[model samples]
Target: MDAHPGTEIVIDRDAGPAGKLAMSIRADRAFALGDFRIDGKLAGLHGQAWRLDATTDETTLSSSDLPAIRQLSRADATRQR
Candidate 1:
């Protein structure tokens, strides 16, 4: 999905039955559950790793692995390299 300039994208995944893994992405980097926003650009995504700025963060993510996100990730990677 194409996000607006300042749109907030929330990635949520059910952790077993009673818990969840959530991440909010806005601006550049993808934020974890702590609400920390990283500055720069979202490089791409591979498996469950979110490449932001020049660093890669790995987690048990869901949205990043979705078909739409995967397509975006491929585009991002192509542009970067």
Candidate 2:
């Protein structure tokens, strides 16, 4: 999930009950939640904050999702190479 250089990736957390939902970004497209995975594209990042677009296969989601956005961002960052 390593974001491309100069790409913006944002993962927002603390918005659900499970407290473990997140979004992934790459470029212009985004992945919200799908078949057990959420993916997105890089939008932008400022300081310690990241801005990303959200997109997914599933049409909708419940209030509680898994893999907080923050965690997803962190994982993607770590995956960066």
Candidate 3:
């Protein structure tokens, strides 16, 4: 996501669930949760924005990345990363 950003992503066993992370997730990015709480970090976060945006309503900006965030399945939500 850092290299090229989109709206969202899904990870099953196919996406290499665990490995040395390849990219940095910006703080603007976030995790989209399922009905239940999940124990994993949102990978490819595209959240590496360390510098804050000017005039960004933090509350609103916090969720701005929602389109790119994906929810974990009920089972995946509880699975440890």
Question: Best-fitting candidate, measured by lDDT?
Answer: 1
- The root-mean-square deviation over C-alpha atoms between each candidate and the true structure, in angstroms, is 12.7, 11.3, 11.9
Better of 1 and 2 by lDDT: 1
Displacement of residue 39 (Cα, Å) in model 2 is: 15
Question: What would the per-residue lDDT of candidate 2 be over residues 22-58, giving only the tens digit for each residue?
Answer: 5434444333322122254332223233332245432
User: Per-residue lDDT for 2 in model 1?
Assistant: 39
Q: Lowest lDDT 10-mer window, candidate 1?
A: 32-41
lDDT of each: 0.43, 0.37, 0.30
Residues 1-81, model 1: lDDT tens digits: 434454465656653354545343544434433332233334344434443432444223334334545454354455568
Question: What's the CA error at residue 15 for candidate 1, in Å?
Answer: 11
Kindly report the root-mean-square deviation of model 2 from the true structure over all alpha carbons: 11.3
Q: Which 10 consecutive positions of candidate 2 have the poorest summed lDDT?
A: 58-67
Q: lDDT score, residue 81, model 1?
A: 83
Query: Which of the two candidates, 1 or 3, achieves a greater TM-score against the reference?
Result: 1
Off by over 4 Å in 3: 1-38, 48-61, 71-81
Q: Rank the candidates by TM-score, best first.
A: 1, 2, 3
Cα error of candidate 1 at position 56, Å: 35
Query: Per-residue lDDT tens digits of candidate 3, residues 1-81?
Result: 123242232233222334321211232344342222334433332343212333532212122232233432234444555
